[model samples]
Target chain A: MGVIFLHTLNRMRGTMLGWGLSLAGVAILFMTFFEDIATQADTLKRLMQSYPPEVLALFGAIQDLSTPQGFLGMYFFSSMPLILGIFAVLAGSGLLLQDEEEGVLDLLLAHPIDRAQLFLGRLLGMMVVTAGILAIAFAGIALSTQWAGIDTAIVELAKSFITLYVQLFFLSAFSLMLSLLMPGRSTAAMTSGLLLFVAYFINSLSSEVESLRQAARFTPMHYYQGAQAIGEPLDWGSLLGLLGLGLVFLAVAWWRWRARDIRITGEGAWSWRGLLVRSRGSSA
Target chain B: MRSIEGNAKTLDDPMQIPAIEIKGLTKSYGRVQALRGVDLEVRQVEIFGFLGPNGAGKTTAIRCMLDLIRPDGGELRVLGMDPRRQSVEVRERTGYLPGELSLYPNLTARGMLRLLNSLRRHRADPATIESLAERLALDLDTPIKNLSKGNKQKAGLLQALMHRPELLILDEPTLGLDPLMQKEVLQILREARAAGTTVFFSSHNISEVEEVADRVGIIRKGRVVEVLEPESLWDRSLRRVRVRFRKAVDPQRVAEAPGVTLLDGSDGTSVVLQVTGEMGGLIRVLAQLPVRDLETERPTLEEIFLALYRNDEED
Candidate 1:
């Protein structure tokens, strides 16, 4: 298990470096404009008020445009989940499926290690990589806050990044589980990507569109802190619930993969029709 | 044909357990049955060759023994342990080379091997790996994606032999090698057997198996049709003889000879006969005829294999 974990981490070093630098660069870019936005705060506030309520609802009620939290929240934090979620979904779905599709999993599984150990080792490795990238991005945000002389507590920034980390972890876990049940990695990634978009839109539009309010509660986006974490206390119930759901998905993926047949490349793609037919025949 | 069960009981040490024992094993993919009641026993410390043509369930049976694929019914034991219940232990003592080998293309051969070695309880000796690579003529620094098919096959063989397991199961181990490398691989297998490793390999190459395997098992249509010594196959294979007589003679004389069949008597001076086993009887019969010239052709291993399968179907 330790060997597999270490090997997984080593293999993912390139992904860590690439995504890490890109996210940090984006954070720095976002921070540089904070002072300019603050100087025109009065003019922008009047301009924002002139727009319809529906338009304002999309960015989430801008309470105080002049504050650093409000400025960052409106522009940066609103799209952070979707930005990080792309990496999460792709990595989670590809972690095992890539090897399986490339035909290397059979050789790896032939070793003395059991399936459970391999699953958990790779999962832990991915979680660490996710955390590492998030930390790099946070460091950029912190250094930029000091440079710009923004008045926000460092602890509050840490809290917001923690919420972001948990959100990305949950999406990753969900995608991993779907990869086992779906036909292939692309299908799993596409489904998860579509769900992420839909959830974000539903949650963002719920304030203005009353009909979507109830459905918005069911999406993972509903529990996300977004800009709220920068000023308010942490929401323990939502944080823990997302964390617990991620565990459940991980557990289910492990159960299915332990006994599932590791397929050869180009043998056949697993599909719902084939599964259902087999199920019916067995039941009959 | 000698039965595997009978051979198992006649081993030098009666108390010695077989390296692999499969009973009434069966597997299916959707509607296609891959294995049907496959019963085989491979004794310890011998080179056992499994011979079967394409789609004959050779890979499927090998996969079941290693617990790579679950059998629909029946039982399998590897190294005296149940594969399903103690798979990790079974794997710990066994080394396998998959039929279609796949490796991490991004990693160099050395790096990939190190990763595999780390998975086992006892790591392979670096000296042993270096020697195996030298013997196989494989470049350790080359990435797998850059290696040729034959080189990739050499890499696969090195990993399987590096750990020195008690039992080795290789499926088509020499598929893409040059003739010289194939011979080298056979020598390696012989050396492994000398060190008391039970070698169970599957291949459709008859002469290769005939040269190295102590015993050979023939599988057809998901069943073990025969298990016998390789020498026995040579004994049963047919040989063709053609003779030119100095004068006209009756073809019936040669037809009545033991193990000889008169295939052609078109001209008055020539006769063609197919002989099975020894040619002693035909030679004696020919001495009486007015012979001028004689020629004979040996049967190929492929022809012998087809004959065996055809005989099995007849039975």
Candidate 2:
């Protein structure tokens, strides 16, 4: 388990700089939201009057981006999920595949651990990284809120952030499954990207398209409607749904990994994308 | 099928049981048979070599033994336990180096070793790891990404050997190392064997196997053709003589000769004959022909191995 965790953490080490920068951006937005609540909301409200109602729906009907909940939704939920979703996807894209590429998959599997243990250990590692990112974001948001003299429920905000981070477990699991089943990183990345995009789109479309509201239940992010969460208290149903989906993805990942044969290639001329395409062609 | 009762010829006491025993193990990848009833045995304290070509069943058999892939049919036992049923136990006693060396590039060599060591219940000694690092000339501080290929292999060897398991299963162990490092690795294996570690290694590198292996198993197209003591196999086909005669040799007379092959008598002025088995009979037969120049060459592992594979293909 430690081996898998360390390996997964090692992969994300290269992207820590980018993660810090992105968190900084989120911090700036968090600060701006509070400052606006104190002094700029009135002026912003007057300016926002020019925008159509449809535009509000498109961005999730934000009546007030100045309030803490509204601000958290706009900064953390609205854009952050997609951004962090990408982070989750990209961070996990090589969790299993990279070992296969390095030709170390055989070496690792040769140890006493089973496929389930390896998968779950790696998933736990990704969960830790995600939890750390969310913790950092929570701290940043909490500090910024206090620094701006906008005192809302920091615990409540932390809870929401924790929930979203928990949601990311499912996203990470899905990405891991794609990483294992798909031959290459790019293929896994593209698949995870498409899945995340579609999940987000379905979550949004669930509100607009009457039929899709129920249909979107199939997607993992359908449970993480941040707009609704900010307006209301919380939704346990969606949380459980995402959690179940994560477990299902994990099971699928384990099963697929058990069946698949990882081809060991060391610094070959063929890139991951090329391998994916080549494998696809060969199979077809 | 029931166990072959009499076939169980114990080479030594019950304490000297093999670390790994594979019998009639078969694995197929769609149309291609990767391992076809390959039987092998690695004695408790000897360095066993599974020598074969690239596509042969060496890797497949190793994977099966590790329980990485389920064999289609046959019996396999590691530490007298079924690999499929008791892989976890088998793996605890086994240290394997994959044919292709791949390690996490982001972690420093020490970090990677520490992590793998943490995974095992019986942690490897830090002193042992550090000593191995020093001996292999591997930098513990260097991230694997920064290390050259040879350094990565050294790190892998260090990590695998650090715990000092009862069995070391190395596949193409000397692939990336220089001659000196290769010699160092061989020395390490010898020392490990001396310490009562059973080393089951796979390689096509003849010299490496010749240097370390007590017994060699030759595999071809997923089948184990032969598992013989290296010395006996080496000595089995040593006597061979080839001669080019000054005058054309009668094909009928050469064929009738005890152990001489009239390879070609069509070149009327120069006859070439191939002889095997009896050097004395070949010497007598060559005396009858007006021999001009003679040359003899020892058959290489490549020749013997290729011939074995070719014969298997024919059969």
Candidate 3:
């Protein structure tokens, strides 16, 4: 665990700091306009109604513009998924592939650690870093809301933040598992990043395209559902589904990782266990 | 085979447990075979050299011992424990240095060592690390990126040696080092073996392997083709002999000489023969003629290595 976290943090601290600070910066930048927007809430709401439902859905359809939750839900929550999803994809692919690609995995593996333990350690380290970034975002938004003199429901805000985090957690894990199946780092990162964008688009356009509503169910972004957390109870079913999917992805990642041969120049031949596991109808 | 200079006990103890043992180990890539039934055994406290050219599966065999890569078929034991089933136990007792040493660019040498040391089942001694750093003339405070390639390699060596495990598996251990440092590293390996630490190191340089290895396992095309002592190879040294007869003698008589193979370009002026053993037969044949000047040249290590392969091919 120490080796995994130390090595992961050594490699990833800069990326984490950059993403976390910039995300919080973006959230803070959006919040500065909150006070000015609150004054023209009625007019802004009418303007939003004039746009197509697709645009409204993309922005997480706001019912009451005067409230802080509605204002944040419209801009911040709507766009945060894309930012968080991109970070997740990068982190997921980089964590597993960095050592091998950089020619460091063999040296690290020379230590007294098993494949399963190493996999768990790296996965946990990525999880902790992702959580830390979202925690900062949550704090930044909360402070910005308070400074803007809006009385948002604290419980609702916390629940929304938790739900948003869970969605990204699952998305990043699924991407990580997807990366395990890829041959190269850049290919994995690009593939997972493209998947994130596609999912975001499908989830957003589901409102306008009736046929896509069913399709959105498969997109990871569909489970975020943070826009409505303040008005009603949090979606436990969707949250559980996301959690379940995250576990499945992680398990698959482990299943494949346990048997994969790592190399410095490039990938090695597929292991016998990898083939055996695949033939037994496990993760590919 | 024990070293010519090794302690008598290692050679005397027929019941001694082998430090590493692999029987008919086999591994293959999708279409390209990487290892083809490799069989080798290195006894405790012996310095075993794994010699092969590039892409000859030396690194693959080392990786299998560490459980970093699984073998397709074989029974492999390190310290009498199965590498696949008791990997952690095997790893805890064995220290490995990869052929390509890559350290974290951001971490200081000390930081990297400390992190790696933290993973040891029996924690590595910090004093051991310091002593090694001092001996190697390495800066522990410098970030890995700031260190030169040779400096980084020194740090890599320090991490593997600091723990003082029962067995050390090093792949191309002296790569990317200056000649002076290379000699010092070999001395360190020799000292480790003298201290009863089993050292299993690999290299393509025949002289380096001959300098320190107790027994050498020659690998070619993913198989251990031969295992022999350096002294034996030295004894069988193929010599190129030149002879000039004062008077014209029968070329057939010199060409068909025992323990000698007449090389091309052997004309009346000078006859060149590749002699593998004692020069008694060649000397007797040359004595019969009016010999003027005689010359003998020994084959280089590389030539001898190639000769071994060439002999194997013919067989």
Candidate 4:
């Protein structure tokens, strides 16, 4: 477990560097708006003068971008979760699925570790690294706000960052589940991409599409985006729902992975037991 | 054809139980059968050679025994433990060099060894590993991606041997090595055996197996066709004799000689004989040939392996 976690952490170092740069860029952009809210507010109003409320709502759905708290919400809450959420999915899928693709899983499984321990160890490590990335982004946002002389509740801002990072936990689980179900890395990557895009579309279109509004309840993003624990009372119900979805996806992924016949370089022939098991169940 | 269970003297008789035992092991990918009722055994402390052509299920059997892949139907025990149920224990005592020597590309040779050492959770003396590396002429500071195939193989050998496990399971261990390095690996295996380590390895190289293996198992179409001691095998299989007569010899007379399967007779001066059972009868015939030159050759391991595979193909 320690070996797997260390390796996962090592892999995330590169991705974390990218996240740091992005957060730094966003923080610089937020710094530009700190000096004068009235002028910025006027510019935003003028910018939205010709656009419809739906379009402005897409742009302004979170909070007024005039105050530090609102600006933090716009910069960190509105963008970081989505950016880091995708990053988490891509990273998590590659972590375990690449072993299968490379066929190293065979050599690894020959060792003493159990399947459950390996899964949980890798998942925990990935979660820790992801949490670390979000924390760095949070630190970047806080410093930028303070340097700009903006007054905001640190506790409230911290809560919002936590909510955003928690969204990534759900995405990592969902992407990992997709990785185990697909046979090849390319197929797994495409499936994770489709899941992420579909989830995003579902969350965005929920308000516009009458039929999808209630259907969005099944999507994790709906709960994560709606949790909005900052600048408001914490929504325990949505938080619990997101947590439950994450656990369920992880369980399904574990079940799928336990039985996977990992081939190195994808060169080995198929196993008949897999066919027997599939025949006993659904085709999938 | 020998039942590992029926051979119960394994408990009391040191030679009765093989160090490695596999029975009725069957595996398939979709419609392709990788192994079908494959059974094999290796006596304790003996150098057992598994010889097979590509796609002949040698790797599959090894993987199953290592518990890397769960077999569909089989019972496997290595060093008296079920590999699937006790993989960690098996791995702890077994040194394995995979067919493909792939390590973390970003890690240097030393880093790769350190990582494996950490995973094995054993105290691998740096000095010992360094000496092995130096002896193999492998560079320790170079990243694995930058190393040539031979160097990568050397790195893998270091990882497998540094821990000094009791059993060495090497798959094509000499791949990418210079002839000298190949000889070095063979000597290392011999040294390990002398130290009481049971060595189970697979190879396509016939001479290497003939040089080291105490017993050889030939597999074809995922089944063991023959397992025999080299001396005994050479004794049983057919022999070749080339006789150049001083003058023209009678072909019919030579054909009537016992145990001589006539291969060819040209110009009445030279003759080839496939001696099936013994050289006793052929030697008797050659005494009367007034031979100018004579040579006798035994069937090589290569021929035996090819014959086994070709027979499988015919079947």
Estimated TM-score per prediction?
0.86, 0.81, 0.87, 0.84
Worst lDDT run of 10 residues, candidate 2 chain B, spans B1-10
Q: lDDT at A58 for candidate 1?
A: 74
Better of 1 and 2 by TM-score: 1
User: Which numbered prediction scores highest in lDDT against the true structure?
Assistant: 1
What lDDT would each prediction earn against the true structure? 0.85, 0.73, 0.80, 0.73
Clashing pairs in 4: A103-A264, A270-B29, A271-B29
Model 1 residue B15 lDDT? 32
* All candidates: DockQ: 0.57, 0.46, 0.65, 0.34
Residues A5-101, model 4: lDDT tens digits: 7876786778776776677677767676667753477686567566764454344254556766565555456555556767877876876877666
Write the number of the candidate with greater TM-score, choosing between 1 and 4. Answer: 1
Residue by residue across A10-115, what tens digits does model 2's lDDT show? 6665465457456856775767657646367677767766777445444554556667676667556776667788988876777777667667787778777777
Instruction: Mark the 10 consecutive residues where model 3 chain A has the least summed lDDT.
Output: A265-274
The sequence of per-residue lDDT tens digits that candidate 4 reaches over residues B221-301 is 788877877566545556678888889988767777777777889678988877766688777877877889988786664
Measured by DockQ, the strongest candidate is 3
lDDT of 3 at A81: 81
Give me the displacement of residue A217 in model 3, in angstroms.
1.4
Interface RMSD after interface superposition, model 2: 3.8
Query: Per-residue lDDT for A1-284 in model 3, tens only?
Result: 76677667666677777777877788789789988888899999888889988878777656576777777788777777897888888888877777888888888787888887788888888888887787777778778878876787667787887888887788778778877887667777888888888889898899789999999988877878775677679889999998998999989988888887777655363544666876887554
Q: Across residues B93-160, which tens digit of lDDT does each residue of candidate 3 receive?
A: 78888888888888899988887888884477776777778878899999999999889989988888
Q: For candidate 3 chain B, which ten residues in a row score worst on lDDT?
A: B1-10
